[model samples]
Target: MIQNNAYIELMKETKQLENSVSKISLRLKTDQQLIQAFLDGNKESIGILVERYQRQLYFLCLRILQDHEDSLELVQKTFIQVMEKLYTLQNHNSFKTWLYRIALNLCHNFLREKQNYNKALSHLSLESSGSFNDPVIQEEQSLLLKEFLEELTEKQRNAILLRIYHNLSYQEIAEIMDCQEVTVRSHFHLGLKKLAGKLKKCGLTL
Candidate 1:
């Protein structure tokens, strides 16, 4: 009995040490490094990669899908697709952009299948009115902004969302959208112009 108890304690300590080492190693590696590790048959590296971007991907899906449960499901699907296709990615350094592209494509497909283009903008509150401390005023502004966003073209709305919410550059957005950088700028500017006109008509400026 004493020998069995000692062996169990030793096994527990070994597992704890292994877990600690894995976490530290994961933290020290970049996304590219982790991807390479996974490609080299280290399956544990993929978990770290998922942990790194799961939340951001979730919100990205949520913004486009406008459904909490659907967003969660899409995030899982996105990672599964990534796992299957990771071996085919040529530019490992662009994994973030590639991951986003996959998620966006999935979102677009979901939207098309559901025929639901009117994505809710509640998660995308306008930042121009930071002075509005009143919750009622904030809600009103959010609804107005949401309506305006819904009016814009899908490309325009996506460009604006990627730029503003994700803080991606025009080049990055272009890569994800599979469009030219100038085209992205054009869509964003045109969207903003239309939104500005609508806001101005309502005695608001953005």
Candidate 2:
């Protein structure tokens, strides 16, 4: 009876050790490893990818859609599309840009179907006018900035958001926007110049 109890304790220790090692291995896995695991029928690998990028993707979608519920749905759609077509991804190193491209496409399709250009401007106008816990001057300046953004075209708005708000490089924005690098630079520069003029006209300095 004493030997049997000792043997059971040994087996339990071995199982615990195995579990600990498994967890450590998972934590150490690189992006490529995770992608390979996902391709090899490991659903948890996809979950890890989602967990890593969900917040940034959500904000990106939110800024584009300007509607919380729609943004959330778009993010989910982006992930679903990624999962479905992940095998088509030839370069794992470009995963982040590829993911952004997917999300941007979804947003563009959604906006096209809804023809919500006016609606988006209206929403931004309403959103910017809301009360904030900042000083009156700061709040007014922010409101003016949003109004300036509202005046820009969709391409200009997207270029400004991706480059300024999200800090994406021009090349990355070009990839995500499906445009040339020079085009991305042009859009960004033109958008900034327009915004600056608007701000100057309103007596607000950025």
Candidate with best TM-score:
1
Q: Compared with the true structure, what per-residue lDDT tens digits does model 2 show for residues 53-120?
A: 88999888887678999989999999999899999999887788899889988987898799985666
Global lDDT for candidate 2? 0.80
The TM-scores of all predictions, comma-separated, are: 0.91, 0.79
Write out the backbone clash pairs for model 2: none
Query: What lDDT score is found at residue 106 in candidate 2?
Result: 92
**lDDT winner among the candidates?**
1
TM-score of 1: 0.91
- In candidate 1, stretches whose alpha carbon ends up further than 4 angstroms from where it belongs are 119-137
* lDDT per residue as tens, model 1, 179-203: 9999999999999999889987987
